[model samples]
Target chain A: MRYSGFRVIAEALTGHKGWKPVWRDPAPQAEYDYIIVGGGGHGLATAYYLAKEFKQARIAVLEKGYLGGGNVGRNTTIIRSNYLLEGNEPFYEFSLKLWEGLEQDFNYNAMVSQRGIINLIHTDAQRDAFTRRGNGMILNGADAEMLNRDQVRALYPFLNFDNARFPIKGALMQRRGGTVRHDAVAWGYARGADMRGVDLIQNCEVTGMRIENGRIRGVETSRGFIGAKKVGVAVAGSSSKVMAHAGMRLPIESHVLQAFVSEGLKPFINGVMTFGAGHFYVSQSDKGGLVFGGDIDGYNSYAQRGNLPVIEDVAEGGMALMPAIGRARLLRTWGGIMDMSMDGSPIIDKTHVEGLYFNGGWCYGGFKATPASGWCFAHLLAKDEPHKTATAYRFDRFLKGLMIDEKGQGAQPNLH
Target chain B: MIINHPILGPRDAQEFVYLGDANLMGRPDGMTAGIEAFHDYLYNRDNPAGAHRELWYHEQGDRSWLVVTRNTVTHEILKVEMARDVARAGGRSK
Candidate 1:
């Protein structure tokens, strides 16, 4: 049912029992025209776009667990398009645009907050690099601003600006970059897709792919066999394991990345901020908890838990950046598996298996690229062509030595 | 996590730096192998969820490279061997 102020007032005047389940829990059909594996945010968004934009019918999204049980719920909920590469900036800018119109498009309260995000600068070299990155973002039609040391100090006076070493010099700000209620994204997309007659089947684990003589046929699942003429694999951390069912190996490794949230406090942090000298980024949630995270655990693992060393390192980075949060008790911490690609960028292209597509290798940045990733993947699955912004994400880029190494860290996934 | 270093007996895992799969040590002969082989060696991985044999460098301890066969699911170390020995056993020569 359409939710509006009048409906809410009417329901309030009555017994207030007009609310219903957002999405249906339908059983999987025997066959569908399109089958999307892993009903995370990207998969659900792809199904929604396929039904709404492409006007395709007979779409099914298979989830091993319930929706929002994966990275869609595990991320720290930051979104930004402040990238410096040609292959990445445009795509992320498109995603930022999608984020701006997402709540209206899906008719849900996602709480898309564009408070802004700032990358603190410590060194002159960092300033030069950020200057270049800011130019790149502006060229891609995204907003950017360079804040001097006094301006940053005026904005966030609690920061340790006077540190003898690694003093805060400046900051690169993106006025439109911020966070959204991450789980709401999944629910909104699921409801939109279900409204468009797309089946969302949860608790259906795909065990294997049924490829017949180099062509796609169906998939073997825990429930039973489900036939599909076309299949798109959008599993993030499970990319390697799932694609292996089709006798293909991906240039991806799974590593556990942890995030933390502190106890609730008064409204403090006005925007997302990243430490200049370390890999610590933090933002204050609407509920007042400070949500933050750092580097990956730096090992290959499928487990959704991290060791203590990285925790200590992240806390140290936080303390080094802002000494005021030293006493805030950590409320909880959790981990999510990251599909760290060889070049530290994502891949969204067709595989050698006919009618089977792939979309993964999102490293730690998958949360921010959800909208564009789904839009482009749906375009590919419907039109059999890459989206204009995603033309560089082909699998052959690695074979041709055209890696989109955003951090210029070569082929090391852990470093990225 | 503690790694039973072959020579040092047991060392904190924080003392070592991770370098990913042990398959990286099986470098192909660039003179004979084509770009496909090089690409596979550089990118493709058998990233299993169970036991994974990966390389770790003792940068803070003895600066020795070792291979640790650990379970990715449970983070339990199964065996640890000096990477040099594993390389020699796999028919690598200077």
Candidate 2:
């Protein structure tokens, strides 16, 4: 297993002679063992695993933008296996295991900090609900802690102690959960996949998929045509459009999620904090910047610009908890599009088609699931069946009423 | 420390205004009323010398006014945050 995805990436970067450059505009292959579309986290991870597990070289990953220039780099960098579903629980645990070994395996530094992440509970009902989630985490062999107000303050000194619109009465802590360097994650996967002899074609958007007699033959890209034995749609926000090329419809809607940052300040906050009472959470980047975000803007369009309310929420949260940060200048704000599924989880299963596959609909949480999603994706792409880790993330789950409704609200997927 | 002064009796901080707590009430959770009463607190400044609080924050005008809700006993909502474009006119935060 040492000749894993990380090995592949390191091998690519430190060529046999150590003088050759790692990446180039890889020419399209006439045929390959497997072809993955969308070179984001899922795409790159898919290629890396396909090479490691299946020894499937001659594989190709088509990307519309530069590698990691998509949603994979646009997430809040949160890493947690605190899921409350059946199949998702084990696979995310697999991801947590992978995150732990990434620095050693890839010869790269992902800054995988295992700082505890606590989801604050403001309402009594919410306290009860997350209490069960805490139990679930513990039962699954993951680390967890339930904290009262004094404990929360001791853990996070910057949090507002006395008053919150929804005061933090308690929280569910997953000490194993934290964050990674988002962009570095994408780059590590790309380098690893490239080292394993996988073709990563960048700026190569798939315009159409050619199918005949119910089998995928190849794809037509904006750059040119590339023949492949199989294909996957890893575009999170644009999944609907990409899958349409294969004539498939998924129960997915695209929305925009925004994040903000304040002027650089000396490190005061240490870990990732989510104000469950309010729509605010923040993490101090290694560069001394305070990175945070508010709500999801509550509208649907490909537009990646957020309104002021979200910024106000984030800034207000900072001021309330710390108070002294009021004079800290606001530096920058940004947004990214996301593919929200009906159930607040991703759908990583094979379509009815013979040569097409999918790994889309990851909520804001996909960054944590990168390694597992790719590992399971590789399994499905190799054995020509559903993966053991991703059995619940199936297409028919919705139609058959077997949806893994994590939030307990089966009908309200888009809200989160 | 600045909030421990006394206020005139029957002279109460209105609702919606975010006051940390009364100095005497120990900056008691700002005289909390429902939304309607909060709006009414904006107009009425009863001339009760004993009741005159340090800060009369009109919270209806802006949520940024939560800054006053921290430690002060009584907060007066002065102004609300204007709509999107107005903020832009004043140069939006980056």
Against the true structure, whose TM-score is highest?
A: 1
Residue A255 lDDT (model 1)? 98
User: What's candidate 1's i-RMS value?
Assistant: 0.6
Q: Candidate 1 — what's its lDDT?
A: 0.94
Identify the candidate with maximal DockQ: 1
TM-scores computed on chain B for all candidates: 0.96, 0.19
Docking class of 2: incorrect
Tens-digit lDDT track of model 2 for A131-175? 887777767767778888888878776666666466668788888
Summarize candidate 1's per-residue lDDT along A297-334 as a digit string, tens digits. Answer: 99998899999999999999999998999999999998
**Model 1 root-mean-square deviation:** 0.8
DockQ of 2: 0.01
TM-score of the A-chain for all models? 0.99, 0.92
B12-67 per-residue lDDT for model 1 (tens digits):
99999999999999888889999999999998888889999999999999999999
Candidate 2 regions with alpha-carbon error over 4 angstroms? A1-20, A320-322, B1-94
